[model samples]
Target chain A: MTSYVSDMRRRRLLAGGAAVAGLAACGLWATAARAQASLAMPQPDSAEADRIAAEFTGGAEPLAEGLALDLPALGDNPAAVPVRVHVTEPMTEASWCEEIILIADLNPKPLACRFRFTAATGSADVAVRLRLIQSMPIRAYARMNDGRLLAVRQEITVAAGGCGL
Target chain B: MARPPRIWISNETPAPGEVVRVRAQVVHVMESGFRVDAEGQPIPEDLLTGFTAMLDDALLMEWLPETAISQNPYIEFTFAARHSGRLRMVWSDGSGVADEAEREIRVG
Candidate 1:
């Protein structure tokens, strides 16, 4: 009887181990499938950024200058990363910065925020907090009242990820 | 009704034409809806969707924020002090709930 009990216990353990291994393999396969889907999606690239910009500017190529974006090279806390954007152009009624658009490349929602300004605004400078999902480039696009687009980009590495599953 | 928010200004009193920084923050969960609870249930999205600053009657700056913003959202911006008036700020969430606070500033 004792020998039979021991044999049954061993069989149960082996069956449990096999089940665990099968579950792990299933998990890996699911992960790989998700990764493949992500690859098929729009990636964080300048072309994607351009497409977003064109959506706002009607196919106008944003000038890669005239916007100063301040962000830390390494983000220790991805939850609340401070960001500052300053438009170089003057804030006048005739030639003022109309809006400022922020984009987080790796975020599920690439368009972070859009800040609108009027002539009454003293300056085209803004400071805000952002959440990053991974290490990627953050871009700022400033639109002038004259329909000109100015942009700047910066890359940041997040020690801890945020805004991601 | 949402709770009142906290607002801070770098300088309450500034010389005419001087630039002053204004910062405002609110207490909120800012749940992104992408996270799951301990029970594995998905959390619903709740975020501050809009922020607007006004001096007297003129609009100073307005922001359309997103889920990328962290919890207890905070924003700062600078504007030239042109005259003495009240600076009013409002933050609105996706549910249409809004909280507002104002600060009295003087421009000499």
Candidate 2:
């Protein structure tokens, strides 16, 4: 009888070990799948970003506007930059205001931030804290509901250096 | 028992469908893992590593943090307000102790 009881206990242990191994394999498979998805979604290359801009502007050349983008020219701390971008436009549903996008052209992810608002906001004022991988041109694209894309750019100098590869 | 940490939101009042800024500062001793005592013994890593915000009962945001986060970590996120509700914020440390605080925001 004692031999039978010992055999039963050993069987239970073996089953539990098999269950744990199965769970670990499942977890690893899930992680690998996610990594592959990210790898497949290639980062937007410079040419692609430029194409997006050109198509956005409807053949009109992108020119720098006098819009104010508040970021320290020389960021002492690269961790955070309090950025504010204000466009000189009447905030009306039909009056050419649509969405504001913040782009860090040199950051690993060039598309840094985006904002969409209704006419209730009353002002095309956007404020947010953003991360700067390094010194680069921070581009702001204001896409109007009418499909006209306005452009603006500002260069910020980092005290230490730009966040680089 | 220690003092209950205080938290407040600093930004535009929340309204339905409006993206409002939220900032919080909690006062607590966050010990980094690399610290050494006077006798040069390695201090165990005990720091706040996670945070979550719930609007009434639904979770709005959850954060899994890293050691790179500076001491007395600060987090900022924008959430679209759906209705008038209470914002409950909870923080936890590596030692498994948790602290929670709540604030009310009116969203029309």
Candidate 3:
């Protein structure tokens, strides 16, 4: 049978689509047409992580401080690597982390997951496992309730690639 | 049916103004949908879509899990110790199947 989605197109769509899929629900576009729209998004290049984060910050650059992302200097496993994102700023009614986005630049699907927080969460400190595809920089952006955004990036070296697939 | 999950808080009983760490984990395939079977056909996506931590009626945190999350996903976070209540960790899949684990948090 002839292929409807070419292999290269399928690969590119899978890369960009899954990333957008994670954001789709939050973006409020889960309809059937949204799937096609996300798949039609531009192909991810080397700067994929930055572009994804921009969607959340609304072009406002995140500060380098008040946030820290913890991952190993070297991740031996591409399948389940540990990660921790902590908002250094105090969490109070006046200020707290509103949302968090984790991006693995080298992965086929760059946007891994997003976390939404409230004052009840205390410090906005979270830890989870992620699949890393290659030895590259992992970026995290945190949206604060005080109209400020914080971000941190760490160079995580994984042994092999393709774990995200 | 699946087995229950594990939830651990560093200090369940803490004085007011104290913060405690929480760790929770569950079992799931977390299928990425990128893998193909013997016929080289893509596998349909099936994975937990959301995880939540709640204390009584208050929502502490929520995580949206994607295919990049590992099998048998695990997560950890921290919360302030306030009034005593039941702390619950809930995990839900795309089909709206919600599974949860709970613990009594006695804040002094």
Alpha-carbon local distance difference test for all models? 0.79, 0.58, 0.80
Interface DockQ of each model: 0.33, 0.03, 0.33
For residue B35, what is the lDDT in candidate 3?
Answer: 65
Sort by lDDT, best first.
3, 1, 2
| Candidate 2 lDDT over residue span B13-89, tens digit each | 56666755566556545443444554566566666666777778766655544332334555554455666678887
Pairs in steric clash, model 2: A134-A163
Q: Write the per-residue lDDT of candidate 1 for residues B1-108, one digit (tens) a residue.
A: 856687778899999877788878888777776666545666677788999889999998999988778788888888878889999988888777578888998987
Give residue B51's lDDT in candidate 3 (0 to 100): 91
lDDT of 3 by residue, B53-97 (tens): 888999989999876688888888888877789998889998785
Sequence-dependent TM-score of model 1: 0.78
The count of residue-pair clashes in candidate 3 stands at 0
Q: List candidate 2 segments past 4 Å from native.
A: A1-52, A161-165, B1-108
Q: Quote the B-chain TM-score, candidate 1.
A: 0.88
Best by TM-score: 3
Q: Residue-wise lDDT of candidate 3 within A1-165, one digit each (tens)?
A: 347468768887877787667765455444544211111121246477777888888999889998899998778787889999988877986678889988887776778888998877777888888886567788899998878989898888888634545
* Model 2 chain A: ten consecutive residues of lowest lDDT: A33-42
> How far in Å is the alpha carbon of B107 misplaced in model 1?
1.7
Scored against the true structure, residue A69 in model 2 reaches a CA lDDT of: 80
